[model samples]
Target: MGISTDSTPRYTYQLPVAAAPSEPPSAAEGAAASLQDALLVGNLLWFVRLRWVAISALTAFGAAGLLVRGAFPPLGLRPPTGWPFLIAALLLLANFGYLGHARWIVRNPQHRGAAWNLWVQIVADLLALTVVVYFLGSLETAAPFMYLAHVVLACIFFPRWQSFVVVVVASGLYAACVIVERLEIVHTPGIYLDPLLRQAMTGHSAFPWVTASSALGIFFVVWFLASHLSSLVRQQERELADANVRLTIAQRDKTRHMLRTTHELKAPFAAIAANAQLLLRGNCGVLPGEAAEVVRRIAARCRRLAIEIQEMLQLANLQSADEQPKPLRLDLAEMVHWAIARVGAAAQARRVTVDADLAPAHVVAVEDHIKMLLTNIIANAVAYSYEGGTVRVRCHVAASDGPVITIEDEGIGIPADKLPRIFDEYYRTEEAVRHNKDSTGLGLAIVRHVAASLEIRVQVESAPNCGTRFTLRFPRAG
Candidate 1:
């Protein structure tokens, strides 16, 4: 080997080039793609089943036509020979095989190449229809129009180019059949060809050719338009899917940023509030009334800022997919009492009285989330209520509906126009802002998000100055 290397270099063989790796789909992208594939597969399976049913029905009808031909001669239907019936039975068997194939594809996780299966079905259908049309007097009767069904199915289930391929193959097969018949290359027995219609449009010399050309033209035009429209619809769907993905990513990023910023802000406000509290308590030194009052106000403002930051954080978490709620069995009445207690100080401050009608109702929900939901709605009611107004909290199980918790307030009610926007984050009705200048506008947004996450239905009824009622319908948990 050393001696050979000294004299000449050995040739090295190059390996075949490998394909580049494709990017893996994200969870959301994968889910969306799976949904689209499922829809396509479902449509194809439905069409296949429908075709089987149609074939069975047509076979029965054909058999009946043959049996009753002499009995009812005035029906004007010519009795077909046994050959067509035999062909139909074979087609039915083929269709049964296809149905089995389709079922396997649907049930098997490893079978992802469904498009190929669909193409096979389309081609098989086209060939079968061509044979039937030939047996039914090719071009003389309306049997040739049966090709339109294949075209329509291809347009719906296959890609544009695939559909075009179908149109071409179908048109070619039909034209070839007509030409062969006209040339007397193959004679189909017991089949009627209408001579008048064939010779009506063209002279005898080119009548069949002209008729075949016109039929081909119609097939091409119909398929072209149908395929074009289908392509447009598919393109729009892809564009919409991409838009949704982008929107989801953008929203997730926004929520993450908001969560981080709020967390950062909370720490500083908490420290400031603690220091202000210490100063207000005269821990440093004795202070004048004015300075003490100012310090107290600073402490209160810091506390309010802290609460607002907390609300923003909660809302961000609720909007995020990362935060899964921990659901547990909870008594509705106890949660309602806890919510009323949490807002007791606020209610007392506003001079609002809370009335409750308790009922024993069990539901599966995240305790903190439910508590937060109840607190926000009840606090909102208390905030909007006038001095000495009544806030009613009711927990009951309706006969038709499951368990219900309603918070009704005799405070300043929301206007009908603003009801739709009340749950929007950072959105405050003008009345709400006037009622509580310190409102963060995230309360009802949190309520809605939590309710939706817990699968609880919330309904709001309100009229300006009359009252606002918030109804939460909880699905009973076993």
Candidate 2:
């Protein structure tokens, strides 16, 4: 997901540049690490896909040269179809290997570092391209320009020093090929007619020297410009990430302050309810009929407010820092049963029957949060159900062994338009409010927080006056 660009802070003075990605604060190192890993994997995949284009270009070049071989001598050209086809075949096999290696890195990240994977790819690709450059004539054709692809990519994905290394290696390989060819140590049938204007150009002793020198200069110049631009981009990305972290910290601190304030408010609300109860019970003095009715309403509202406040505090605790419960492997079916038990009273009061279909499904998550998450959803299922309705609770693992739990209810279903806001704290649809007067509207919000914390996905399906189904897909336990 994209963070809001507006969050980037404006500065009046220029900031000093860092040689590397600045370290994110200690609290968010994991985020930075994850981002880098993803970038590596993504770049690896991109390079593999792009290689197919290179292979096709080679194939087409070979086919075209072969088809028009008759016209080559007239145009002072002597291209070889066999070499291009051979290079294309080599690239085709290597591409398959690259694809397999990328998948292995994704599945078994600990086996190899991402940087090592990228470096291997860069070296292999440069070697292959070096061969292509030699065959096509580093000074004879535009083939040397292909090295810029690696230079630009290296700049984008690597630090300044690492990018410099790639530039040096590429330039060196091209120079080596050119020097050996000129020295007649390795013979190459460069694409030129020795009989035509080509011999005049080739006879110049300083021509290859100047061409090689100019190409190397351009390579270094490109590395400098590309790396500078890439560094600026990296700087912006780090700043954006830091800004997001700060925003998150500010939000958590705000939740903590709200948690503290709610704690203080709870007592006053309780006292009000207690005094109202005393009046209703005639503990102080007998009250007139109208006053008694008024007291009853006040007491009822206070009780309802107290429940809302309690759920609010629960949510605040879940969102606050330093309060997440430790994760342990637990059975999804067992948690579902425990949740059913927790909501038994409400289900019984509403005459709602719960049907459970348990399967062997397990996940690693905090026990209390799991219970709280399940209990809240189950309670809502019961509360919203019509009298004598049935709520189905199912737990099972998917074919991939990722656990799934579903809670479906035969209730006054959520309106399609209002379903989006159902998880918003304190948000309730008019239909929901009319159906369940005492609904606190925080149950789903709490469930959402727990699901997010556990890395579970919650998908809802509903229709007005029909029924609603919530599907919770849990990440496979490690």
lDDT winner = 2
lDDT of 1 by residue, 256-279 (tens): 899999988987888999999889
Per residue, candidate 2 scores C-alpha lDDT tens digits across 1-478 of 1112243321111112212212234556576667788888899889889999999999988987889778777876775668889888988998898889889989986654667777887888899899888876778678899999999999987999999999999999999988887887887767775744544665698898998899999999999999999999999988988787787667767787989988998999999999999999999899999999999999989988898888888888787666466789999898898889988988999888999999978899889889888988899888888898889999989997499888888887776667767888888888888989999889988887887777777878776666678888889989
Root-mean-square deviation (CA) per prediction: 17.8, 10.3
lDDT of each: 0.77, 0.82
Candidate that scores best on TM-score: 1
| Candidate 2: RMSD to truth | 10.3
Kindly report which residue pairs in candidate 2 clash with one another: none
**Model 1, C-alpha of 458: deviation from truth (Å):** 1.3
Stretches of model 1 off by over 4 angstroms after superposition: 1-25, 49-53, 56-77, 81-110, 113-117, 183-186, 189-205, 286-294, 323-325
The stretch of ten residues in a row with the least summed lDDT in candidate 1 is 13-22
